[model samples]
Target: MMFDDLDATVKALFDDAAAPAELRAADISFDTPDRAYKPAQATVNLFLHEVCENRALRDEARVMTRSGDRYTSRLPALRVDCAYLATAWSAQAGGLKAAEEHRLLGLALRWLSRFPVVDERFLRGSLRTPPQPYPLSTTVAQTQEGRSNAEFWSALGVPPRPAFSVTVTMTVDPFDEADELAAARRLHLDSTVMPHAALAGRVLDHTLAPVQGAEVTVVETGARTASAMGGEFAVPGLAFGDYTLRVQPPGGPAEQLAVTYAADHQRLTVVLSQP
Candidate 1:
């Protein structure tokens, strides 16, 4: 179920693209092009071969929304790359088979190249309904790391054919629900209203260097703030309580620490390992 919506969206892209008469009747398939597989008719096969995190587009900032008296903080969605090996198959024999397959593959490439990013109109299932905030980036005929074409085909126990790699970058949310918290309230001492407690923190790497632009969040109150140039951050208007702080550096892993925010203990330090 991981890439179910993405898979459907990719298929929908192919289904909706305008094609020549020769490819109009050809079937679109997601099955592996292995040795035992043989198409009874002309087909376009997009076999999902690799999936991995796209670190270049990675974002660690939390998205926070405020309503009436409540706040909701959601972790940033992860950017992932889904790579597919696209190949064309034909049931015809000899020269005719090769010619048809080459033409179909060429047309498919042209159709896909038209859109560097998949259009929202072609999105399907969950990808279309609520709509993802991030764009679906696409790359055609790009070489992917970790595997060679010949080795991949050999592993599938099939002869290598003319194929191109298509990698689609999509977002996946780690949490289904956002963390909710009530608005922080001020304390009253006799006739005077005391200021609300605030948590101040600093972010640093294992080398003790300040990490700027790091996101810091108070788990219990959904209070969020970004570290300054000196890795300093302050979350204002927080009620005194025991809380867990989540610190995420840009393009780095997230780290959490148990903390207590009181009148005397309002500041802390967090060290994040280099990614």
Candidate 2:
């Protein structure tokens, strides 16, 4: 979700900042233009340079949504630094072309520097009204340690050009693929009067303290439930069989457990040790 938001946010910032400059708004383009571009026109291109996983912020081990009592599984959210190449372009034919290019580059750098963090007002589209309004951190790193700028341009098959690099850290939510796939139906079931077994447990962290709001999913089946007050959860209608359970708690890492659920073994306790 946040991947696209990052793109929109970058472009919107350029557009909003260029309004008073009387310069045409920049766009997402290549470092080297394919066609002739106006010298006065300021061309800005943002490219995904690198993505480094952020481990400092709070992370969601498991993404979830409650439909009544059942909690469904969704991929875990990722916190990352969206690195990009903010390149500017202008024509070089006219005598004043060099001045115009410098002006364009200066405008972008100055306008962008205004906001150490991209303002919410400048954020447009999906990012304008994000569900998780975590303000991304932006930075300009001219010299990237251990990486060669010459090698970068060579790989792009273009001559070296002046470009500013920016990194924005964003929290991205996991995508639910359920909508893209066709729904399956259970057409048959045993009508026998046998009682299904119950699974109950309290999730705990490495400290052995209760972890609240954890979701316990039976991997063999999609049935899952959330840990409530005191970190307790129960699923009462599970059929008797060997079950693989996945335990995921908010603010904690997910865990996997192999459990055998017969008449003698019903209650289960799970603990998470790693993130």
Candidate 3:
């Protein structure tokens, strides 16, 4: 039965030639607390031993828990997490010997060595450390029956300890504000540019006050409408059309003005007369 199952599993892998690229033979979540998984060495050893021993369980298998052990005695299933089975059983098909088994196990270990281990070296050697404390209370106790528990711990190469939680944060910069309302009203009307009074200088001092966080949005009818983000904004590359100009000053009232664009090369002066 075990041989048949193994044969079927191997055949299935070969049959599925176009497996998804995203499919992972083994997956580990860094954020998640360590789950008690069978060690590659132990899982391989147990499965091979079971096959050789012919002590296969007919029904359910006993699974271990953090709190205690449960009993069922079901035949063990192969897992990518416990990939040692690939080599162990592959060699076990022939005459079973220590040297051959060791060689296969070494290869499997090398293959799995690519993954990072949590605690590679432990200083507390043979101190007979009591069970480390865990955050969650689970049924899979330390004293689990059969080789599953041992295999799970061995795979991690570390005893079950505890899990942790973490958080990430980000900071945003405040917007800049500059413009004075007193300056907007000081400008005298110069030449009539097109729609409104045309001024000489780049800007009318009192006409435009120190406006912090002010955004200018120019909407062109029958054309594209664009908005100025952050600092200062002005309409450029504009063709003759009716455009709606909107300005929003931080902590102040919003102003919207409509103007018709003509081929007069006109300059429009925007002034906030009232404070």
Best by TM-score: 1
Model 1 lDDT, residue 266, Cα: 76
For each candidate, what TM-score against the reference?
0.64, 0.51, 0.21
Candidate 3 residue-wise lDDT, 162-220, digit = tens:
21111111111122332222223256764435443221112122445443345555644
Q: Write the per-residue lDDT of candidate 1 for residues 1-275, one digit (tens) a residue.
A: 65777888777766773746566578888898898889999999999999999999888898888999899999988888999999999999999999999999998898888779998987877777677889899999988577678888988987899999899988787788889988777765531122545788679899989999999988887889999999988898887788999998998888988998888777778888665
Each candidate's lDDT (Cα)? 0.85, 0.68, 0.33
Top candidate when judged by lDDT against the true structure: 1
lDDT, candidate 1, equals 0.85
The model with the greater lDDT, 1 or 3, is 1
Query: Cα deviation of 57 in candidate 2 (Å)?
Result: 3.6
Q: Kindly report which residue stretches of model 1 are placed more than 4 angstroms away from their true locations once superposed.
A: 145-147, 183-275
Of 2 and 3, the candidate ahead on lDDT is: 2
